[model samples]
Target: MRNQGSLRSTLHQRGMRMTPQRQLVLDAVRELGHATPEQVCKRVQGTAATVNITTVYRSLDLLEQLGLVRHTHLGHGAPTYSADEHEHVHLVCHHCGAIDEVPCELLDGLADLLAEQRGFALDASHLGLSGTCRNCRENPTAV
Candidate 1:
């Protein structure tokens, strides 16, 4: 999770006032890990007693713009947000709808290959590679 101090400072530098609502939203997003705007609103309201969904959505957008959070469409569902900044690859299970994050370095060989052979810079962090997980593979009917 992102440190609250740095997030607040980033907002301050951007001339964005840090409201309790915004803080609550941030906390919700961080705590919820990869969560949608609706999930964030629910978490925040559960803690703070009141919060608007629109406000949560707007705050998420602003936070993304500020680089405080990252979002990715892991499957057919809404985009999921994460506060983790480390480079990583998202492995989404097509069968059970489970998601796992593997270190970005795991794809270093592929990245280098892409860079050398295709002259393309591969950002594995932004990718959500989908496949059937081991459990799903073992039990084809699990899903």
Candidate 2:
């Protein structure tokens, strides 16, 4: 889990002013990890509240710019926004499209291989990982 102060510091850096809409979007993102802009708006609307789709998208872009969020196409569409910033791999359920994250050790090997074989400098934090989640593993026929 990330500390609230860290998130506040990041918002402070960008001089992002607080808004009820943005706060609702942020809360939705924190609750539902790896979601699309449409998904975010839907989640926020679930509490008998309303926010424009444009507002949701704008907030996501702002968050990404501030490095407070990261995105990947783990599910579908352009990319999914996630509040967690840890360098981990995403495991997506093929059946339900559910997403889960796990620590990634792949970068260590890739880094070593690049240095030893190709002599290249690469940062693998931007890499995206995708696979089946545990539920899919247990229910193969669901997909």
Residue-by-residue lDDT tens digits, candidate 2, 4-35:
56657767676866566666777788788667
Per-candidate TM-scores read 0.87, 0.69
Worst 10 residues of 1 by lDDT: 79-88
In TM-score terms, candidate 1 sits at 0.87
The pairs that clash in candidate 1 are none
CA-lDDT, candidates in order: 0.83, 0.71
Tell me the deviation in Å of residue 67 in model 1.
1.5
lDDT of 1 by residue, 3-122 (tens): 778888888898887888877877887787778888998898887766788889898888878877778878877788877564578899887888888998899999999999999998
Candidate achieving the largest TM-score: 1
- Clashing pairs for model 2 are none
Residue 134 of model 2 has an lDDT of 77
